[model samples]
Structure formats: C-alpha cells, structure tokens
Target: MPSNVEIKAALRDMRYLTQRAKELSGTDGTVIRQQDTFFKVPAGRLKLRDFQDGTGQLIFYERPDTEGPKLSNYSITPTNDPQGLVKVLTDALGQVGQVKKERRLYMVGQTRVHVDSVEGLGDFMELEVVMEEHQSREEGVTIANQLMLELGVKEEDLIDGAYMDLLLKNQQNAHAP
Candidate 1:
C-alpha cells in the first residue's frame, strides 16, 4: 500500500492561501473537477473518483480520523469506465454518498497541496506528504507540519475525517427535528 501523511483544514482565506502556495511552489497549478461516489464498506473507505474527463480511479484508503497529520494507507486502480464501475459497486455494496468539488492542485516539494471548493461544504485545503519507501512516518509528519505553516493554515482550522463524513453529518443534521 502507498501511504502519505495527510491533514485537512478549513480555509479561512482561499485567495491568500492559494497565492502563498503558488509562490512557494512556483507553478500556476492545475484545476480538476471531481465527483466521488462512496460505497458502504465494512472496513476503511471505498470510493470511485470520477475526474470529469474520460478517466477515473477506484480508491480504497484507511486512516485515523484525527485533527492533525495522520498516516493514510491507500490503493488506487485506474479505470476508463468510471460510470460502469460506479453502477456495479453501488448495486453490490450500496451507495452511501457523493462529493463534488473543484480542486486546485499544487506541488510543494513532495507534498500535494489541494485547495478545494466543495459543494455544500464550503472551501478547504488538504496537505498530502507522499511518503517514500525509506522514509519514516515522523519525517512525513514533519514535512506536512512545515508545509502547513508555509500555507498559513492554523491549528484551529484542522478537521477530522473526510469530506464525505462531513457531508453526511450535515445531511443528518438538516433532517433532524
């Protein structure tokens, strides 16, 4: 399994954070529109990510739901038939939820900085420090923390769990009496 040290945070100021990220990374970055369909799984998370192009990926990942940087172990398999796979998976496992977002991707050293505008959830930022085979988890966490500082992300802005979890919570709240 490929692993990374990752953190998700609420974006207080997307303009400032994005500008800082561009200055640090020295690139204009790429914008990707994505829709992720999550399935009910017994363990971990299984989602089919559609890239809005002709390509997509089936991803399974496990990580602790913590407020700070944590290790995520994941596997990804690319597919040219995302729609077909989504149908099969939904039928077999049952669909849980979907998340649609426009993600701006920036590379700062080995870290992937994703500034995202998610539907219904507002804006957020994520830092993924791709871990090398020989690297320790501590090293990845250290790199993630440093990038957090550079990106102007405060500790209070950090969030636990994925966007799917947050969306589901919001849905439940909306229906509650």
Candidate 2:
C-alpha cells in the first residue's frame, strides 16, 4: 500500500491561506467539488468519493486519529458508475455518513495543500506530504511540520480524524438532549 504523512486543521482565514499558497506554488491551483459517502467497515475506512463530474474513486485508507501529522496507508480505484457503486456499497456495508466539500488543491513541493469548505463543518485545511519510496516517516513528518509553519497552521488549529467524523460529531451534538 502507498502511504503519506497527513495533517488536517480548521482554518480561520481562507483568503490568507490562498494567497500564501499561490505565492509559494506559483500556480492558481485547481478547484474540485467532491461528495464522499463513507461505509461501515471493520478495520480501516472506506469511502466512495464522487468528483461531481462523471468520475469517482473508491478509496480505502487506514491512519491513526491524531492531531499532528500521521501516516495514512491507502488504495484508490477509479469508477465511472458512482451512483451504482454507491447503491451497491450502501446495500452491502451500510452507509455511515457523507461529506460534501469544495476543495482548492495546491502543490507545495511534494505536499498537497487542500483548502476546503465543507457543507456543514465550516472551513478547513489539509496537508498531505507525498512520500517517496525511500523516504522515512520522520522525513515526512519533518516536511509536514515545515509546511505547517509556512502555511501559518498553528498547533491548536490541528484536527484529528476526517471531515466525515466531524460532521457526524456535530450531528450527534445537535441531537443530544
């Protein structure tokens, strides 16, 4: 399985981060609209990510739910029939939740900087440090930390778990009596 060092954080200012990312990456970046439907799984996480186009990806990933940069092992398979696949997976594994977001992707060196506006969860940022075959986890962590500094991501702003988890938590809190 391929792996990368990743960090997710709640963002206070999107414009500031966008400007900084453009300055560092020397590109405008790509905007993507995505809807991810998570399924119930035993060990890892499984989500079908629809790109809002005709394309989608079935992704399975495992990572520790930690505040700092952590290693994520994942596999992705592309699909053209996302709706059909979603129905099948929902019938088979049962759907847990879904996350909808508009994401702007920027590349800084080997790191993917994601500035996202989730449907019900507000704004957030994610840093995914793509590791080379010979790279060590320490090296990936070092790179992620450096990028966090450059991107003005504070330690307090760091988040644990995925947007789906956050959305689910918010739902639970809303329904709590």
Candidate 3:
C-alpha cells in the first residue's frame, strides 16, 4: 500500500499531465460533474457512477472499510467492457441505494480539484494533488489551492463529514417530515 504522502505526490503529477493534455488539445480546462451510487456486496463494493457529461461507468472496489484514511478503488468503464467486470460484482452483493451528488472537477497545476454537493448530504470539496517523485505536502496543498480557485471554491464551503453521515441526517429529517 502506498502511503498518503506517496499517493498525494502521484496525484499531483497526474494533474500536471492532464492539464498539459488539455492545452495540447486546444481545449480549455474542463469540469466534470457526476453522481455516483454505491452498493456493497458480500464479495466487494460496487458503484455506478454517472457523469453529467453523458458518460457513465461502473466500478468495483474490494478493499475492506477498515479504520484508516487509506482507500483503494478500481474502476471499469462499462462502455468498453460492459457485462464482464460489472456482472461479477453485482451478481454477488445486491443493490444499494443510489447516492446522488453533483461534482465539479478541475485541474490546476499538478492537482485535481473536486467541489461537490451531495443530495441529502451537503456541500464538500476534495483536493487530490499528486506529488512528484520527491514532492512534499506543502507543495501538494499549494497545487490543490490553485485548482480550488479555478473551480471558485471557498475554504468555508469545505465540509469534513462523509456522505453517509449526511445521508443519515437527511433520513432522520425525512422521517420527521
């Protein structure tokens, strides 16, 4: 498993690459909005992610939700492979409810910025700044900030809670309503 530091560095690099690609293609940096519904099965975790840009993909993540910040995820584009990977997981777990959210994704420097609002949850922002081979957190946070600005996100809009927490709270309100 890669340490958070290492993962952060790699993400920064990926951001840089993505930005360069956009420039080369003569396209302004783009944003992607998406909503993802996740289901957990006995075999693993399955997710159906829908991008507002008219694209969707299914992902299967097998990592145990152990206590920690480390999360491992792998995705398979259903458009390319369709039934192969998705069927293996869906056949095992059963369907979990659809999680809905709108996410704005942007690239800045060497990082990826994700500003999101989840239905029944609230507003949240995530910065995935990839580091270079020997970059530090300070460098990564700087890059993250750049991307945040590109997306017009404010630090105050950042929420520390997870989606499930917000969902449960919303559920309670619905019950009372």
TM-score of each: 0.99, 0.99, 0.51
Top model number, lDDT: 1
Please say which candidate is ahead in lDDT: 2 or 3: 2
Better of 1 and 2 by lDDT: 1
* Cα lDDT computed for each candidate against the true fold: 0.97, 0.94, 0.50
- What ranking of all candidate models by lDDT puts the best one first? 1, 2, 3
lDDT of 3: 0.50
Q: After aligning candidate 1 to the native by TM-score, how far in Å is the CA of 40 from where it should be?
A: 0.8
Point out where model 3 deviates above 4 Å. 1-29, 42-45, 52-54, 60-91, 131-161, 172-177
Poorest stretch of ten by lDDT in candidate 3: 1-10
Report the lDDT tens digits of candidate 1 across residue range 56-145. Answer: 999999999999999999999999999999999999999999999999999999999999999999999999999999999999999999
